[model samples]
Target: MDRYLNHHLKISGVSQQLFADAAVTAIQQGSGGLLRRANHLARGALIAAAHEKNQIVSAEHVRIASTELI
Candidate 1:
């Protein structure tokens, strides 16, 4: 998970533990349709954080992104 986040998401400056916890929470709170939806939300969160000039994707970003999703 960490590797995918680092390599695929191109994110940095966040502790692996923090990111993992946020991801787990996002997945758990998701609609339970598919893992892909959770993953998409997570990735969108990272992008949102980046857009906000955040060095790392925090729980706040995930929460915001989750809300923006359908």
Candidate 2:
């Protein structure tokens, strides 16, 4: 993970559980946490991209990355 992303995420003050819930939302939305295996792959790719870019993680990135995986 990029230091920049970690810093912003810390500044955002979002809890780890909250992040988990977000993942849950993605799963419920058919983004593959529960059933769509592709979604998980996409998510991993998104994290890698964001980390490489040193950017804060956002929902848009998640959506785009997940769809891209599909």
The best candidate by lDDT is 1
Put down candidate 2 lDDT per residue, 1-70, tens digits, no spaces: 2233335346779433222334435434544334345336335545755666833434444555666563
Candidate 1 per-residue lDDT, tens place, 12-64, comes to 56544435566656545663646577678777787888799976667787778
Clashing pairs in 1: none
Supply the global lDDT for candidate 1: 0.65
User: Who wins the TM-score comparison?
Assistant: 1
TM-scores of the candidates in the order shown: 0.57, 0.36
What stretches of model 2 exceed 4 Å from their correct place?
A: 1-24, 32-45, 48-55
